[model samples]
Target: MLKNSLNWIKKYKIHFIVWALFMLYETVVIGLLFNLYGNPIIYIAHYIVIVSIFYVHANFILAWALRDKTNVIWRLPFIIIIQIILYILLNYSADLILIGLNLIEVKGKHNLDSTFILRNLYRGIYFLGFSTGYYFLSNFLSQRKKTEELEKEKLEKVIQQQKTEQELIIAQNAFLKAQINPHFLFNTLDFIYHKVNMHSEIAGEAVIRLSQMMRYAIDSDEMENTIYLADEIEQVENLIYLYQIRKTNDLNVYFSYTEDVKHLQLIPLVLLTLVENIFKHGDISDDDDIAYINLSILNELLQIQTVNLINHHKVKNTTNSGLNNIHKRLCYAYGNEVSFQYQSIDQHFKANIEIPVKLLKLPI
Candidate 1:
């Protein structure tokens, strides 16, 4: 509170000084106009008393009266009562000072006039009215300045929020691009090592297919946002083939898709993640543990389904990671238009996803 008062004083100090000077000039003008310049004692005494009373009334007494305008019953009457008390006090004190100095005369050429009583009453009320006007003007300007500050602060917050979101998007894209490099290179190297030793020529074939899959992923990140239905299915086939040679143990994996898709475009890397999840978590050792993947274009709708026997005892479940990434990417790209549903029941886990693919341009 003290700091705020100091700040307000600093801000209005020049105005206060200028107004004081104007008051003194008005006093001098009134004296000259009345030809009362010869009575220095009377005029000078009035200058000190009037200036002191108006200053306190404007800054202190009026401030209290206006503090709660809602309580008119008490505050309004309080203002009137205080002004009455101050008027009586000022008159009584001025009389004592003038009489003590032998400046006032009751029965002589310098006797006080009855008209002077009316004039002093008029001056007191007149100064109070002016002081009230200045108080309201100061209040209006303070409110305007506060409102401008709040609006400017709100705008700055919104701009900062937008800037942070943009930066996060750029970082997410970079992180996703980095995700592909290590996994692809390691798989390619493993396949190449087996092929170079001549222990398995089939592994060399897997290496060629892995390179093709990587090319598709990298190209999709660079050149195009969507690819043909056939292109996606071909890459899924290569991913499955790579996994088949990857594990020493036998695996049960199956895929089915219609060949009648005349026009289909899809976001890349979606189907590959599902197949990777199956190999990582599905129970392939059991002859009955089959990982079934289905894809079809029916009436312009593209559907991908994966069903597998979940290895309940496995410590790590790779399906959650793959599905989470797919969900985030799908929502970012397709919003709510794409349908994706997945759940686990007992030992079996099922996922079905559908997207509108017939809207794409016809394949060349």
Candidate 2:
């Protein structure tokens, strides 16, 4: 009940302010009337009883009565009837107590007279008007508050989503940087080992190619997603050449292009990582177990298809970090514009990737 009262006060602050002013006016009127009659104690007692009755009506009966959802015509009459009944009882009690205390002489034989009924009926109408006004005011303010809260929540959600995207970009940049270090170390070791064994001068060319790859990676780090197709192709070619020199078994790679690729762009290192995964787990041997790769760009789309025979005797020891990283990069860059599929059937491993050229193109 105390909680309800506090809530009511907060909700009806304006109404309370107006009610306080009116109560002050009533107090002044009572003081003047009592001074004219020279009966201060009787007037004080009378006001105390009236105030107690008004509190009960405002806080309990009228507060909920005005909140009813019935039609206005029905609600008005119902509330008026209830207020009249309660006020009649209150006035009768006040009169009996005043008579018992000899505060006033009873000119009438009984309290239930026409004058008593008419006076209380007028008071009931006044109370109904106040309650109805406050009811509408409270409802309007409550709805406004709810609307403001909803708007604030929506704004907060949008801000949080943007923050999450920024964090994802940062994390992806870190992962890309981490990937570069290991790839560089692996390729460099292969080149050096091959040079020492075969006594070939190709190791000097490999060092220059590695330097160029490192420069590209460093320069591209500031960019968000896309990189030139020419740059990606160059990296893949260099890595393939390094593999060809290092492996003892027969490994073949074929490269063909239909047109100049100056207009095309793609996620940096995307194709290179796929080719790396192929070399990492694929079986490159004699006869039917050779690796094959085909890449083409036409009609504003990049198509990559790779096939290699899987060696069941070979144990798979690599983590999926490279594939997972590329997948995440694709989603961040092109969303659903890129499609990837992988399958192993009858000892042959096949992978296909298609990326929309429009997404990879530089903005005009």
Candidate 3:
């Protein structure tokens, strides 16, 4: 509460300073010049009422009256007349209370004469005019500050856009310098495959499978953020085949999926990552203990699950960053609608991912 009070005071420090200086001038300099010095209590009480009127008039009365520009001319004047009448009545009441309390001594009986009425009328209008001016000036300053802020934001956005464009241009140039033409690479691979087929058909097929996986990986960067689920599944198949050929068909793993999922779409590389993890960490060489990967659509969700026996003989040298990255990407793409989880059960490691597929973009 004290901190908030300090903040409020700091925010309105200029207003406080102006009111203080004005009160000092009225109580000291004017009193010295006119020789009309009186009770300190009277000065303090009247000044309090006057300052309250100033703020109430500017912040409330004028704010409401001018809120709608239409019909403001008559609305403002009528409210001000009512305010002045209240001010005059308050003045009389303040004087009566002061006299009853013996806070001030009265020299003569008070009368509502022309001079007295006119003097108070003039005083009320004088403060009203100052308050009105302050209201407009405050509004002008506030609008100017908002305009400056909007311009600053627009400039920042423009600068950021230009920086991004420059970085993209640099990246494109670097890629062009480093990239080998896809057509040439594929032609060379095909030539090698044909030559290898003359001696060993299995080796030639492996080369072709590797070439296809390479093409998928390279083409993936040029594609959109997501591809047809069928495409990724095909790549996963090729990946498994390559691993099986490497192990001379000794690896024991199964990939199962529904045909309905062929038309559905998903971000690439996720399924491949799961399967690669199995090969990297799981003991898939045991035919009696086969690893499992299942893909299906159930209750408007696409689910991918994998279960494999842990290879305790292999060195457990991994940071699990691939699974972490997959989780982050899935969450980014699907918000709370996607889930990825992995844990060890007994001697087997299991991982499962589910993503809501109701809004998937279908290919034409």
- Clash pairs (backbone) in predicted model 3: none
lDDT score for residue 194 of model 1:
55
User: How would you encode candidate 3's per-residue C-alpha lDDT over 1-364 as one tens digit per residue?
Assistant: 9999999999999989999889888888878999878788887777777788889998999999998899798999999999898777777778777888788787787666687678778888999899999899989999999999999989986875465445434433533543677666666667666766665676677667777877888898888888898998998999999889868799999999999888888887889899999999899989899999999999988889999999977627778888999999888777887889999899999999987777566431
Model 1 clash pairs are: none
List candidate 1 stretches off by more than 4 Å.
1-199, 315-319, 360-364
- lDDT, candidate 2, residue 151? 92
Candidate 1 structure quality by residue, lDDT tens digits, 31-141 = 789955535667666656666666677778777776777876698667756675576467657766787778875555433445655666677777777766766777788
Clashing residue pair totals per candidate (backbone < 3 A): 0, 0, 0
Q: How are the candidates ranked when ordered by TM-score, highest leading?
A: 3, 1, 2
How accurate locally is residue 349 in candidate 2, as Cα lDDT from 0 to 100?
80
Deviation of model 3 at 152, angstroms:
1.2
In candidate 2, the residue pairs with backbone N, CA or C atoms under 3 Å apart (3 or more residues apart, or in different chains) clash, namely none
Better of 2 and 3 by TM-score: 3
User: Which candidate's TM-score is highest?
Assistant: 3
